[model samples]
Target: MTRRRGRHDGQSGASLHTVLTAVGANVLVAVAKGVAALVTGSAALWAETLHSIADTGNELLLFVGLRRSKKKEDLEHPFGYGQERYFWAFLAALGIFLIGGVLSIIEGVRSLLRPEPLSSPWVGIAVLVAAACFEGYSWGVARRQLRVRARELHRTLAEHLIRASDPTATTVYLEDSAALVGIALALAALVLHLLTGWAGWDGLASICIGLLLIAVAALLARRSKALLIDESAPQDVVRPIRDAIVRPDWVADVRALDVIFVGPAELLVIARVVPVPDAVEVPARDLVKRVDGLRQELLRAPAITEAAVTVEDVPR
Candidate 1:
């Protein structure tokens, strides 16, 4: 039997490993919070549990996307199933909004209406701390993966997290951020409930956390939509392609250039290249090969999987 290797052999494996770990941790945390909420009747604890469940679901979706997207190019999809990854990612974002955002708001409002008495403060604190530790570890794993890319792109970690072409990068970042924020909100509600003897504040905190999650999820959805709709290439990719095609000795001038992103790390470029006299002297076959080779080499840095080049007759 022939064994098939994954598309992201090295880097993608590490990413998948980390995300799986994160999902496991979130599941554990959710179970713990659900138990605690049941025992103590704390709205804050219940809200945290719901958020973790949503996060766990999103991670599973990401894993499915990562795996499905690795399918080899077939007759139907000559370009491969790369966009399958983005489509699954969009679904994950929507799940985050619906399961995490809407449900959380509803629960928070219910707590405000029925002010349940606070339970054991110590248990809530312990669960929050444990959840925090796991979340921090997951976030750390994602940060380490991004460090190299950030340095190569000459951008800070924050900038790369928001703008990187890879959907995994954005998904991981948003999930981690939401996890931490949710913990804070849970903690705040528990403390307020303990001090003021008002369960409504705990519910209010839950509402606030839900709003924050909604905003974050919306941002993620917008970005994924951009990718799905064939958004224009990022500056990092566009600038490099322009520099490569405009190099002297071969290209005299470029009359027009157009670029579109086909996948996370793939772009299709179409250009009108006016070759110099020396370039024009080459045989037609040789010129085509040379230009194709040049294109492949130029695109290597940006993870371009395929490049097509056409040599047009020098326009009159």
Candidate 2:
């Protein structure tokens, strides 16, 4: 049995913390941006307001996913409701696309067709700067969590983001990154409108921010889809599990092994093993006991929530 534990087991609390922090920041930012958008009549500010609103709703969905994913196994769901997290996260991504990305693009096009003068440019600028600061703080919290986990897995930040089983953490990080960039675009557009008195620049910035959201939402959607479909664990985790199963002297060979990520920080392993020719001569009852013992030992790996082993005779 491999004794290596998964590093992510202890980070669930951190993921929840990151989600909560984002929810709080986005709520505050959304309200401020909405007021600024109404006051200044800036298309860019309006787009940003929509973006923040979508983000606030997405964060709430993530909170629901996190809570529901912790439900214990029952008669109906023998494996528990782990995939609920992925399902909700996927829905959140769709919300970003429909509510934030699509609407922003439409508003941008409408503004282009019929431009509107900005009431107070400085107010929008101040609001954008404050929003950026809040987003930066949230991004920092997510980045620190990813950094620690990536170091433990010996993977780069990009690799960890793509392969991490915990969707809440990754979603927050990506959302915050997009929010920061959107703030920059809105600020630039406001400045351009102020300098040139052309509202078209503001509309263009809104379009750009919409495109950014679309891209981020696509990436998150793909990741969540993969998780919902039961993606396999990485090779790094698979290899050690195989090594552990073959460690017992009674095992002559590991015929086959399969490991799948059933949920965040949980794995379902099924393995076929060939018993030593001499060991197979033991009574049938004893062989069953040995196989059960081996299964128990494999369960020691923190990520392996469930393991099933089948013993077979050595090849002639």
Candidate 3:
């Protein structure tokens, strides 16, 4: 087995920074929104509070995932514990759906059934605006990172985000985006409640925020699940790897290749190759040296952390 270093091999610092930033922002926002919700009795503010709380908790989970994923390979897990990140991230998505989305919807329904007078509407308005600003800052950080990664991969933002293997990055970006949208919805609902004395509008806004969280949670969950199940690396990554492995003079032809993501930036590559007949006729010790050389060449690509190559006879 040949293993190479990857870009994300030691980049836990960046991922931890992003998660910590979000956790701090969401904790403050959640506290402020909770107090404002109590003062105003606004369903929208209550829903926003739940959203912030969910986000804070999710960030904590991501932090744990990042830490646990760094555990070294052991006898139990020969491939290492990298996939623990995806497992924890998947749990975080479930938490968002159950705690954030469900509770918001329930609160909205309750408010709609038994309308209550809202007091201190201005407090909710002020709190929501501040929360938007905070969430916006967090969103900006994630967006910057996303843009950098996308440029490196030569893919559009949407395309890169959809196929990204790092659950921490994707989760933070999606959570911050949802938080911003939820804040906007809360602001609009508060404004409408002030304009018209209808408590139903506030409740409706809460429902909208809940639905948005559900959609985001679903997407995150799907991505995490795919990662846990061992999805293949993107073509952009695989093609370069194949090209690199096939360039040597001793490699006559590459008959088959399979590349799968074993972790955020780790790939498990298995290939079958046909050697030049002259090269194959060499002594066994020389053949071993040539194959080792070929493996080393494949390892030069940063993303191909592990490679297995088999020499096969040319097909009739």
Report the candidate with higher lDDT, 1 versus 2: 2
Instruction: Summarize candidate 2's per-residue lDDT along 1-316 as a digit string, tens digits.
Output: 2323333446778988999999999999999999999999988889999999999999999999988877777779777777888999999999889888999999999999999889989999999999999999999999999989889878899999988988888999999999999999999999988899998998999899899999999999999999999999888778889999999999988898988887887898999999889888999999999999998988876777789999878767
Error of 3 at 149 (Å): 1.2
lDDT of 1: 0.78
> lDDT values of the candidates?
0.78, 0.89, 0.86
Model 1 collision count: 0
Ranking by lDDT: 2, 3, 1
Clashing pairs in 3: none
Worst 10 residues of 3 by lDDT: 1-10
TM-score (C-alpha) between model 3 and the true structure: 0.96
lDDT of 3 at 259: 91
lDDT of 3 by residue, 125-215 (tens): 9888899888888888888777877898999999989888888878999999999889988888888888988889889988998999999
RMSD of every prediction: 3.1, 2.7, 1.6
Tell me the spans in candidate 1 whose CA falls farther than 4 Å from its real position.
1-8, 281-283, 299-302
Please give the TM-score that candidate 2 achieves against the real structure: 0.94
Candidate 1 lDDT, tens digit per residue, 251-288? 77777777776666666677777787778878889888
Better of 1 and 3 by TM-score: 3
Cα lDDT for residue 167, model 1?
80
